[model samples]
Target: MITNQAIEELVAKECERYELERSGFIADRQAAIRELVAQTGILPESCSLIEFAEWKERLLNDWYTRRRFAGFFHRKSEKRCMFRMVKRLLQNAVFRLRKKQTELTLDDELKMEEGRTVAFKLSSAFFEGFYKKTCCNGTLFVSPGHLETVCIDELSLLFPLKYPLLYARLTAKDNEFWEEIWRLIRRFVRFLVVDMGGKEDTEMIQEVSMETVLSVQEQMERGKLEQITSARHLLNSLQMTGRNKFREWLRTESRKREEILLSEEDWGKVEQAKEDRREVDTCGANRRFDYLLDIDEKDEYEVCCALVDVLSYGSGKVYGELVEGREKLARAMLLLYVENKPYEEVVRILYNTSDTSKLVNLRKSVSRGKEYLKKRMADLIKLYKRKGEVPFATE
Candidate 1:
């Protein structure tokens, strides 16, 4: 079993290893920057802003080229060294053959030559930016404080890589521990990103340092990590809620703008409209002669089931014509209304979707079914009346 102490020790060791690697990287980067400044003969204070920008772009291009080439030789384990060596040899051979066959232009030859020497170049935009930001009066001078800032930025990128090592180590002993830790790290990173939008790497890394990891470990030991995670989720939810409320407020304002307040004459028109509706209602009341007998719920279900059976089995040409190849609709209605299944269940049984958003579509299907039944109810009543076999009790 991986105890909390064991986990903490492992984290501390990994963090120490990361710090060493980060320090070395920063030292190397600073040295490279100094070399490039000396070799290029472009003093930062002497150059115009445009020239400085172009120089930085060139440095970035060189860094990207070197990084890409180094990535080719990066191995996860020492066991793969022989394999990579063989692969590299084969690639070199293929490249030589291709070079011999093709007529290389001056540009192509220069590019190839640059590729060969890219490993020796020490131009990294990351470090260049760091140098500019941390230097005193734009001078190419390295200090411990500048190196620390750069190290923090590099650690932000390095922390994610270290988690997989923790994951692998904990898999045999305590998988849940690794998972919980991973969840906290992921949530913390997301919260940082959202809370500090478009901030520089160093600024973001200030929140994601080794101290933060140790704090998380302490929180996990005390069983408070879950509460912390829940708080973060609540914060995110509140942000979304605030945004939604703002949208709702904007919509309300828009609607208020579109609305026209009524004058006294408009009020009189509203009263006149009420009177017209009452007159229509009175006429409708007087014209209705046919009465529908009330049935209990059980009887209603039986009658509906019988009607569905008639429609489904194509009992008559009229029934078949009314159904019109809407068997799926009929089934959906039966499951949704008659069976009293929830929309999600009906969707799973019908459209195979449990997604809440898709439940609206199921509701729409049930609504269409209701409308179909209402529209065809008159036809069914007429058919039953003509045959003198109406299912319901009549007046």
Candidate 2:
């Protein structure tokens, strides 16, 4: 229903709008770049837009590489304090060496004033080529969507900076500069398609509605739209019930997936996999305790059997002695060790408090409880070994 004539008219209107605001947009971007350069001191002040853009790309790339390396090293050396200290010292040394090398290279390059003039000429030529590629005869293409895509892509290439500008020391304002340009282009396209009142717009809306209905029907058949009884119901519910209600329904349904009916053999395989995982976890836990206790390799099986029985008896006595009127410590130990809950979870469950002081007290109590239990267990094991029996007395 949309003709080339209508498309051309929309494009022409958009082009006229862009031309009117082009100078202001360019000036704003130039000012922002100058401010960012001043703040970061990453680029020379005399550098033109083209030089600055290139330098920014290189700096961001270097920053990303450094961040990735730092993350990897941190994770690998998490438990090694000495290794981490050594790494920090080495990194500082390398940074100083690189800084010196950069200074030497800058001294050898041409003077700043001459460089600025040449950069300005190069930037002008670059913009000329950029305009030719993005426009046909200095006018936007007839297809609004295509023109929008082309403009956005060209703008992104010109300014490759994105969010999380940590390395460049740039602020959100730098990102907003490019975003504003994209918004202007998108606003023009949206105005033509959505706000413009004409036969073409009406036809376009109807076509889109039909496509939406078909898409909903397909999703329903695939069991993805579980809450909606039908496509019409979905449309009505979304429109009438409002976005909040629709969002709640989506949130609930997103946690569930379409049920996949499997054969008996497949079910059997899944069960077997779960059982194997449990066995592996049990063996791993046992091995961890054995290593912690430093059990002799030759007598591991015999010592493990005796230690299990000793632990069963000793744990009860230790718990009773520690919890004799201290209900908070008892509950904390139960939630921390018995339930295997995290410190925050245990604090919440016991005191129902997120206060920092409560968390600190809970941690201290848990640490003392752990030491008492370890001492009791060790004494019980030594007694059992000495006399072949553990006495019921606390000592």
Candidate 3:
């Protein structure tokens, strides 16, 4: 409640000489402040000059906001007008929230979980091929088992001529969105490079054909990318409107188009991709799928999986081979580093010394595989920000 002393202090401080000396000019300050205190408690903290100033500003802004809408309903009784304003406020909030949701979309785990298989053919000698591919291309595999080459920087794709899959596929009304996705992918690629050593091999290293990684990808999963294309087309066909009734109706109509867009078998193929992932996540350079992870030690993959599950609404499944391979190679490399194995010996440990025949004279698959794994390790580290991933084989 407003105290007599507080009112007297404010008026006394403001009163002019004549007003101050004037007879019995007692203000109706007690009732006025007590009502204010009843409406808004006058706590000890609120009594501070700075806090009072801030509170006054908030009160004025709120008053202005309410007044703006209050004008529209003022014809109604004050109680009725207040209720009408509340309804308007709720509607306004709903519309704004819908707009925000429209700006962002929930990515399907099926899509996020599918890693596009890529192939890189090599023609140069071991060291030379290694140098070329290593310096040129990168991938952005964001989904669980699949590494979506979100960005292929400083390098170009040859086959299907579909270098950037998203560009080749995604058709969005907002051009800025495509650019933003590209930027995020580029960031992911650069992170991978920096994570892998971000450095070119000081000397010549091994190299491989695009066929190997490509074959591994195909073996890991199946189905042509026509589905991804159709899914995009279906997505594009969607109307971008905010009317609640319209949007609900659109969802129903889209399902019919989806049946036309994809057969039951196709949906099963993509949706059932988790099985392929389970098979793929098992294998890497030397280890099997389940073998790659340090089951006893909790890891970044664990964290990544948790995040994916949350993002995908708990049904997200992460699986893949080369990623498994990369993790394995990285783990082995870390072990090797600890063992103080030299470069040449490390190479022997990686591919087994028996395959030396694919040598200096010919551009062999060995070199390409080595570089691929190196790049893969780099990619994982870049994506996850976890270090000591490429463990050298110590034992």
Models, CA RMSD each = 25.1, 27.9, 29.1
**Candidate 2 per-residue C-alpha lDDT over 3-50 given as tens digits, one digit per residue, 9 for 90 to 100:** 344334433443343331232222343343343343343445677879
How do these models rank on TM-score, best leading?
A: 1, 2, 3
Tens digit per residue, CA lDDT, model 1, 201-298: 54333223323444444444665534423333433433443344334434544653453223345445544533443332333442111221222223
Cα-based TM-score, every candidate: 0.26, 0.20, 0.15
lDDT of 2: 0.38
Instruction: Write down the worst ten-residue block by lDDT for model 1.
Output: 286-295
Which sequence of candidate numbers ranks them by lDDT, best first? 1, 2, 3
lDDT of model 1, residue 174: 45
Local lDDT at 165 for model 3: 38
> Candidate 3, residue 33: CA error in Å?
11
lDDT of each: 0.40, 0.38, 0.32
lDDT string for model 3 (236-303, tens) is: 22211112223333354354344222344543553454344334222333111222233222343333
For candidate 3, the C-alpha RMSD (Å) to the true structure equals 29.1
Question: Where does candidate 2 stray beyond 4 Å?
Answer: 1-330, 391-395
What's the CA error at residue 253 for candidate 3, in Å? 48
